[model samples]
Target chain A: MNTELVLFGVFAVMTLVSAGLVITARSPINSAMALVSTFFFLAGIYVLLWAHTVAVMQVLVYAGAIMVLFLFVIMLLNLGEAAHRGRPTVTRILGGASAFGLLAVLAVTLGRTQALPAQMSAEVQGKFGTMAAIGESIFTTWLLPFEAVSLLLLVAMVGAVVVAKSRI
Target chain B: MVPITYYLLLAAALFCMGMFGVLVRTNALVVFMCVELMLNAVNLTFLAFARMHGALGGGPNAVFGVGHVSAFFVIAVAAAEAAIGLAIVIAVFRSRGSVNVDDIRTMKH
Candidate 1:
């Protein structure tokens, strides 16, 4: 097998397994820890896709800052092992059925698309997914969205502080 | 070389898992984590499509196409969501003394 395929297999397995743990682990802290691992593996997949900038941001934001917030809340709340709820109900069963049904439809649709080229062309392999390319486009063509996102971040920061300040 | 469809399929599976988690888990924090998972899955799809379109060489440096830009925006939004979301979770915990979604039903009454 090719190296790229091998890498994809490894990362895909790791990501899915860790994601499963995130939802299945009893303690919220354990779930958060699982989520950290999931982000790391997902970043690996991003790198395989040649999205180097996104991979870096994934590590920095999701695994680093966001996870810190999750862990902090889990601790502050002092959440014990989630009390075992009763048996799954009809709504739960229906939700599962619908989610799986959606997945099936998505899979079928994707499978029907024309097959993509097996290997990236040299020109794209060289320049695509590079930070320079992304930065150029972000500043030149996508400048407005970039500015808007910064503003949104500012608002979110202020709002979070205000919301969390009441108890402090 | 891996097929782009493989990446898409993987993303779909991950998204399904996240959806399942959201549906089954009653804990608000775990549900939020599932939401994050769903977002990441969507990011994977974006990057996969970016790679595919860039390979077409439609323009100079089209490799880092609009998909990358959109994915970046998604990540930024996710960060903001996490911040605000966790803050809400904390506030809820303080008010109700429980983080379970079932315990926080205010609209029913």
Candidate 2:
């Protein structure tokens, strides 16, 4: 019934609805656009949770840069609505059942669990969640993982070029 | 204080919606979007824990380590994930000439 809950509820709904649209929308472009909205809603939720840094990165990275790349590819390819209609594949059925099972497990776990007692009431606010703090941490304590991620990106980049580029 | 349960529940719902999208959507691009949704859901979980633990100091110092630095680590990873994932999806679409999962039936019976 408070501001946090109100914000969470709004963003939650936005996330769900846009995510649904991401699947059901006919055009790939439409789905990608819906995904942008979904990212925006997610960023809002992150803001509500006091994750100012993650929220900014969510919009800038996912909704802004990544999405622009997606749009470019979509336009370059000029992919139309897929010609063939789908019939259920075994992968889908199995995947759906597994998802259902996971959902049930999570529901039971959360429904029965008690809330952890609040250890401390940190009333911290914004700007502190800026890029600088994130950068410092990434370079210091998380340097190894950070470097690993860079390596992963490098591999992925090479792989993508290999996969997409026309044979010489 | 917004109970952590509420955030967890929201995360669960988002994850489920994303899972459903991955399963039901024929378009590879939509599937990719769904994956992003799932990642965002996980981010919510991380932020919730970060707040509960005082690890990120709730705002400016909102981080993930002993000294409130791990939070940025997660965000950096997420960025890397998005970049790599979209690149792969784009590459796959280019080669296949379609973004429909159903179109890639080579793995099927």
Candidate 3:
């Protein structure tokens, strides 16, 4: 068996299972912990996709920063085990059906793609998805968007503080 | 080498799970986590496509493909979204004393 395919299967299976746990865990803290594992597994999948920088970001920004934030909020809220973790509600049953339907549609649509992976030389593959390559692209081709995102982050920081505070 | 279709299918499955969580989960924070999962799925799709077509143009130079760049932007946006979303959740919990979606049905309370 191909090593890459094997690795992909492992990462993909782990990611989906953890994500399932994230949604199904009884407490919000359990869900948050499961989400962290899901992020870590997704980072593994990102590596398989040759996204080294993104994989690192997935671990750092997602598993590290964002998840910590989630944990802090969960603890602050002091949420306990869900009181109504009972039989599936009508809305939940409908949600599962629609989600499954969406999966089927997406599978059919992606199945029809006749395109194949573009072959790249060893050197190009090395350069592709690197921090340097992505940075160069962001600085030149996507400069405006990069700057806009920086601004958005700043605004979001201020907005979050303002909104989270008890009063104006 | 693994097929790009495999990655795409995995991403699609992940997206579906996230959608299901967002739709069915009642806890506001869990719903927010589901949104993050969906964003990550899209990022995976972007990288898979990048692997598929990153070297279309000028060989080595074309390594700076749109796919990676798009994923980078998505990650940044997701960070911003998380910050704002969590703040809103905290604010809502403070006011309502509960984070349950059913309890948070009113805007004025």
Candidate 4:
């Protein structure tokens, strides 16, 4: 077995398990911590996929910045232990059934797609995940979206401040 | 190399778990965390597709594929979403004194 496959397996398991904890943990702080681990594992998966830039951003943005925001909110709220609600209710049952249905559909669709070749060719692999290559595309053809994202960030920042301010 | 389907399946499972959390959890903050989980699942799909495209000779120089660019936008949007969403959560907690979704029914009153 190759090292790549082993790493993929390990990362995949870590990501999914941590994500499961993020949702199921009764304490929001615990859930936030789990989400942090989830982000880190996801960054590992991104590395395996050869999107090194995206992987770094995943760790920097999701694990570092976004999670800090989440923890801040959780602390600011001072949430107590969520009340121990009973097992699955009707809404939950329906929600789970539908989600599983969606999973089935996605599985079928994914199964149909051809698998990647056993080995990636050299030219295709080279420089694909580098920051330079990503920068080239982002500044060249994808410039408009790049600009738009900045605008979006500005609006989100202003809106967040306005909403979080105590006084209207 | 691992099959692309494995990544897709993993993403699907993560997405479903997130959905289950959103539906079942009463704590608004936990629900928000689930939403982030779902977004990460989507990011996995994007990276998987990007890898596939790159493997298919659609190199990083190819202008047609949107693998990395789409993932970039997704990450940016998710950041914005986390900021605004938490701000709203904080605002709600400030006004309601609690962040439980079931108890914060303003419209019914």
Candidate 5:
């Protein structure tokens, strides 16, 4: 088998297993930890797809920074008691059913779509998924979206601070 | 010995599973993790498309290049998103004394 297929298999198994643990694990903290591994495996899959930059960012941002913050909250909240109760409500059941419906739709779509396009050309491969190219696009073609995202993030930051500081 | 399709399908399955986790689990932290899984799913789609579009040189690179560049930008944005999202989650958890979605629904009225 080709290297791409082999690497993809490894990452795929890793992702699925970690994702399973994210749900099945009893401890909320353990679930968070399992998610970190899921992110790592996902990064591997990205690498196999030749998206080197995304893979690096996946490991650095999601697994590293995000998971750390999640752990911080879990620890600070000390949610052992609340987590044990496991919120069992009608809304949760409805939400779960909707999520399952979405899965069914996606499966049907995938099954119906055949004859996907093949891999990319040679010169593009030579470009080396560099930061420079990405920067250029972000500043040029995707400039508006980039700026909008920045503004959104700033607003989110301010909102977080305000919410956290509100009189309880 | 698996094919790339297998990987893609697996990613899709994991993504859906995570989505289910987000919807079913009332904990804000678990939902956040599920969102991360969704982002990872998009990352897989990006890479697959990048590979499928063929190399990044010649006319294609000069004209419509969606392979690696889009993927990289997406990852950066995902980072920023996670930072902001986690901060918000923290804020909400602090105010409500609980991260359970159902229990924290004061704004619904």
Candidate 6:
């Protein structure tokens, strides 16, 4: 068995299991913790895909920043006592059915694809996921989008402050 | 060598689970987390395609491609989304005294 494929399987299985926990855990805290682990494992998968920079950012942003925000909000809301795992309603049942249906279709479509060459020339691999390489592209070809995103983030920051401090 | 399809399939599964949570979960915070999951799923797809097509070089030193750049854009956008979304959740909780979505349907509140 190819070591890469084996590692991929391990990370993929772990990621799915963590994600399942994220949705099913009774406490929002538990779900947030599970989501953090899910992000960690997904970062592993991203590295396996030769996206080292993306993987690092995934860990830093998703696992570090995003999950912290999630935990903060969950605690601030004092939802620990509201751990009422409500009885599954009809909407939940339908949701599960549709989710499985969607997965089946995706499997069928993606499985039909032929195997792609997974080997990257050493030269390419060296340059492929490096921070410098990705950054170069971001500042050049994607310069406009990058600036727009910074502006968007600024707007979001201001908007969040205004909304969250409504009564203050 | 893992097949590219495996990555795509996993991303699809992740996206589907996120959709399910968004549809069925009543807690507004959990619903927002699900949205984050969906965004991550899309990011995975972008990186996978980026790897497959070798489209990520743009400088004289780097080859030219948009996949990695696209993933970066998605992450940036997701951060902004999370900020605004959580603020809304917080404001809603303060007004309604609960973060349950079912209790949040009225516009006049």
Q: Write the per-residue lDDT of candidate 2 for residues A1-168, one digit (tens) a residue.
A: 787678878888888898878878888899899999998998897776666777887788888877887788778778777666567778888887877788888988988876641454343333334466567666766678778877876776776566556673
Q: Which stretches of model 4 miss by more than 4 angstroms? A: A86-89, A117-121, B55-65
Better of 3 and 4 by TM-score: 3
Query: Per-residue lDDT of A1-168 in model 3, one digit per residue for the tens?
Result: 989878988988999999999989989899999999999998898887788889998898999989999999988888989888535778879988999999999999988875557788787777878898888878877789899999999999999999999978
Please provide, for model 1 over B10-107, each residue's C-alpha lDDT reduced to its tens digit, 9 standing for 90 to 100.
99999999999898888999999999999999999999888776646445533446788889999999999999999999888888888887777798
Residue B54 lDDT (model 5): 49
lDDT per model vs. reference:
0.88, 0.71, 0.88, 0.84, 0.69, 0.84
Q: Clash pairs of candidate 2?
A: A128-B60, A129-B60, B28-B99, B56-B61, B56-B62, B56-B63, B63-B71, B64-B70, B64-B71
Q: Candidate 5 residues A1-168, lDDT tens each? A: 787667777777888899989876767798888998988888787766556776787788778877887888788778663446556678778877877787787777766655343454465455545566556656777678778777776776676566556464
lDDT of 4 by residue, A33-140 (tens): 999999999889888888889999999998999989988887777776876663677877898788888888988988887767235567545767778778888888
Poorest 10 consecutive residues by lDDT, candidate 1 chain A: A115-124
DockQ of each: 0.66, 0.44, 0.69, 0.65, 0.46, 0.63
What TM-score, to 2 decimals, does candidate 1 have? Answer: 0.94
Candidate 5, residue A30: how far the Cα is off, in Å: 0.9
Better of 3 and 5 by DockQ: 3
Q: Which residue runs does candidate 1 get wrong by more than 4 Å? A: A117-121, B55-58, B61-64
Candidate 4 CAPRI category: medium
Q: Which stretches of candidate 3 lie over 4 Å from their true place?
A: A86-90, B58-63, B107-109
What TM-score goes with each of the models? Answer: 0.94, 0.83, 0.94, 0.92, 0.83, 0.93
Candidate with more favorable, higher DockQ: 2 or 5: 5
Better of 3 and 4 by lDDT: 3
lDDT of 1: 0.88
Question: Which RMSD does model 4 reach against the true structure?
Answer: 2.2
DockQ of 5: 0.46
Question: Candidate 5: deviation at residue A92, Å?
Answer: 3.0
